[model samples]
Target: MSYLKCSGMCQLIGGLLLLLLAGCSAGESKFLAGNLNAVNHTSAAINHFSVNGYGGGNVSPFGDGGGMCCVMLPRQWLPGLKLKVEWETDPNPNVRLPALGTDAYRAAYAKHKANYQQHSTIVDLPSYETESLCSLKVHFLSCNQIKLTTACMAYGQPGYPIKEPQVMKEPAVCPK
Candidate 1:
């Protein structure tokens, strides 16, 4: 009887210790990942965007692209969290791709490449209200401005925190 009692007590203590460890181990990541969404508010087109090496879809001006799955974020928001954003944009969104493996393709490709521009910056993540993250929304604004939101609601939905204008204004002079 005493042996059985001791075993039960030991098991309970061990279980309690494990729970304590798990709670503290939530360091840096309890890791809830969500879909990546690109929202564009510029006259140009966002060819691509990435958050800390996680690739997302392209978006058109005043529009949003399809969601890209699985951008890992800490389950709980911590102050001062930031991410590196790298993106490519095209001034002319309507450019047609020339047929591959031809002389026209090479020349057109060069021109297309010349028209494209790249941007990279470290952006502070906007605060979120919930532990359950919905999407990592990357907003590309005019004059090479970028904003990030992990808001639980979708863009343009009621109570979605990222405010947008009816008609976006592009900058007359962009920074070099």
Candidate 2:
């Protein structure tokens, strides 16, 4: 049978071209949208949080909240993938506000609002590989630390990493 042949340099260039095509195609591939969940391990309750502007619902202290609509993720894991997380915390969940438009309401609202805080940070997303699902799991920790995970598994099952306390009460004070 007839055969094709090339010089060593030509063969190297050909291989490199193939690799370049693969890399470029991977870059062009569209990111898949996935659900988002938030886990709050800190003392404060999370009123809301977002990853790159995709909203995740409220979460109680030491507990997880329900899933949100979506967060976009790559079809495959890429190095240095990061997400900007923004979250609002409720320092006093049980605070009661006075009637609106009243002088007492204005004073109470301002004082109460002072305890609420919003935090933002950039966190690198961990590696995940799954064609069926690519959910973003957010974990809010003490001292304002955060972790993001992607997985198909549920929160409490095996192979899931977050293991928050089941019966712990929210602490009276939250650390800065």
Task: Please write out the lDDT profile of model 2 over residues 23-89, one tens digit for every residue.
Answer: 9887654678888997777668898999998998999877877489788887878889888999999
Alpha-carbon deviation at 4 in model 2, angstroms: 54
lDDT for each candidate structure: 0.83, 0.81
Query: What's the TM-score of every candidate structure?
Result: 0.76, 0.71
Worst 10 residues of 1 by lDDT: 1-10
For model 1, state the Cα shift of residue 165 in Å.
1.9
Give me the candidate number with maximum TM-score. Answer: 1
Ten contiguous residues with the weakest lDDT in model 2: 163-172
Model 1, 1-176: lDDT tens digits are: 66556577788999999999998886556778889998888878888889998899888777887479979887777889999999998888877877998999999989888989999999997777676778898888878888888876777889877787624788678776
In model 1, the number of clashes is 0
